[model samples]
Target: MDTYSTATLYINGKWVEADRGASFEVTDPSSGQVIGVAADAGTAETERAIAAASDAFPNWRAQNAYTRAAALLRMHELMLERSEDLALLMSLEQGKPLRAARNEIRYAADFLIWFAEEAKRIYGSTIPSSRTNQRLTVLRQPIGVVAGITPWNYPVSMITRKVAPAIAAGCSIVVKPAEQTPLCARAVFDIFDEADLPPGVVNLITTSRPSEVGDAFLRSRAIRKLTFTGSTAVGKMLASRASESMKRVSLELGGHAPFIVFDDADVEHAAKGAALAKYLNTGQACISPNRIYVQRGSIGRFVNVLTDRARRLRPGSGVDESSTIGPLIDMTAVTKMEQQVADAVGKGAQVAIGGERLREDGLDGGNFFAPTVLTGVSPAMSIYNEETFGPIAPVIAFDTEDEVVAMANDTEYGLASYVYTKDLARAVRVSEALRFGIVGINDINPTAAAAPFGGLGESGVGREGGAQGIDEYLDVKLVAHVLGDAVD
Candidate 1:
């Protein structure tokens, strides 16, 4: 075990250590072991961090969009230069494969630059007033201090999903990255420093105790808005707390995205898509498709091809360059996924190809599980109702478009869904019927900086990507200026 035990927090545009000087272990999810310790912040530290962000908001928000965009552009450039450093850090902490982490870093930077360009593009229009003497227009203004709570999975991207747009829109923020994967996210704050965002504009705090950190902001009047990326359970709680203060909230919560395979689709391609989509980041992603529904004619071929793809996955530590499947983020996740597997099997699901944890190979004693495939899965199984968040693909068969669509929409989550069909009509039909904010027609991964992302139902309110992203931080106010006095 490596002996380094402390990391820094960035608050008010400066790197810091907690006042009590306590540190908590940072485990490598890839190895089920400790890699380092980060500063453990509590309410007191959170208070200070909030003040920093609150104090900086007026000045930051008053600056021109071009200035904010310039900083974001510079940070984007630095991010590209330091890509390897951040990506490796992300993998080491988050337990995702290195390439996935790298892709997130690049994507996170894209969020920054994309929002930078969008910053100046926040459009306001002149209202046509019937009154001869009055001219009315609307202008979008920054909302004030924002509190951003990001999750461990896709830590870098989630942070950028909030921070980049908030700052680009001229809102200051206090960030609380998930304890499991705070380092890389914290390091990205260094870019803010390099970009010279005004003092107290953006702050980062590492706290193992989320309730305490969260409550601080929840109770604070200075924090006008809150954003979260996590499970639906916690998202609701956070929303409730923020409600007391009537704070504006944005939640990007959980998903059990349904992957529907129509009989008309190519089975091989669908199988590959299902395998990759289900197992990406060990399926910890909220957008990750966990429920696979194949039509009657396609079920046999799809399962056979999918199981083969799942079986081919090699499990190893995130440190290993060749390893594709890494461990879940922590021991809790391992336990959770293990129970999910047992529960599914106990409920009569059949293991198709790879089903158990992998044998620990060498140096690091990796927490590796074989890519698992479960066939004959029922909607009542835990894997369907709840998210497994692991490299497990459970295939459930359905007949007819209406049946599949009903199966897809039968969930509280409306985050994302996938449908594979050659016919454009079927693709359009399934896409419209699937109750998700984002849907994949032929593509397994359906996301880009240019498109708006988020969901329709309990998944979350409001969108996060595209030009609409920065809109979350903006407030439109009607300004009525009298052009001239009416001559009777």
Candidate 2:
């Protein structure tokens, strides 16, 4: 994984550096060390990428679905063939554990495989006509060139989630990956290149100047669609900009998901699920549980088990096979965790486990924080209202089912929520009551390639997976025909 030499911009089927030779240093969050240099593309490169996508769109859309599906399937195969390398690269840049990184690679590649089959199934329908000589038909067509802005967290999967569906729907795309993990994006584009995708059908530009690229995408009439995954604020800004040009837009934004544990739930099992949900990817995920609610009767047992699990987690460099928890993406994430914990404690919350940074055990150089659990967390605390995108879980107790449901749905975000209960009737009732796009009833990980994944409200619009994913890149056309006397 020699990222120093490997990181470059992929445009129009060529690997190149910035036009002005400008570049930025990429650091490994685990060690706070410069791992590589990535091309810092400006507005000029962005426009060029947009032009390339526009130029490639017509021929790409004209190709039959089978041709497109073949290329995507090839990408899937190449990704799997090089999964280990991909996983290592991601672990280095993104700061997730090696095992987690390996799992992410598989999940990311699954998007291409899933959409490859989905490409062949973009069906249109025929409508019955009122007159004997009249006919009506409907068609689903590609929306043309797309501009994609992916986030740092889950860099590989975020790119595939957008690019796979766009390509599967016959649209060409230009992607601007997060500055922190551009090497992973470059690696993905390498697979695309080896798959023999047509030049300009897929392009990548690594840049620190995200605003410049975003503005370029907004101003370009050539880019007909915009898809972004990041903060709610940024998503809103991008959506507003896209709306000014009437460009089609889809956003997967921030979330403050709630994890609920009922008395009916197996406390030990629920505790295990909570630990995974709260700490996956070091809680940087948009769908990670921000708030944990336990029934008053189960709170004592649940907290004890959860705290034991947190205490047992080993935090270090992601490359360490023995490490279960990894460093935060940067110092900012570490600072946020500190601030949140401090705020909660000042508001009378008690730290049941860890509550400070990890400065020992060779973790001083990186952005590392202890896995923390806060009890007596109240609505008055900042952690209760804000999305704590770190390894800190705030537990709040509730008296009844309705009370828990109300507490879970008290946020503006509506992304992912979790409810643990063995009562079948109770699971259905609470699941339906929670105002989120995806709910895991007695299950922690609910996302899959074959299921629609997205958020509601400020959590953002549109979906990214399953059969409906391709639809985000397509447009519908209805044709009505009137026939004269038969020529035969």
Prediction RMSDs, each to the true structure? 1.9, 1.7
Query: Which 10 successive residues of model 2 have the least lDDT summed?
Result: 1-10
**What is the per-residue lDDT of model 2 for residues 390-436, given as tens digits with 9 covering 90 to 100?**
99999999998998898999999999999998999998898898999
What is the C-alpha local distance difference test score of candidate 2?
A: 0.92
Pairs in steric clash, model 2: none
lDDT of 1 by residue, 35-115 (tens): 777889999999999999888888888899899999989989999998998888877887777888788888898998999
What lDDT would each prediction earn against the true structure? 0.84, 0.92
TM-score leader: 2
Could you give me the TM-score of model 1 versus the true structure? 0.96
Question: What would the TM-scores of all predictions be?
Answer: 0.96, 0.98
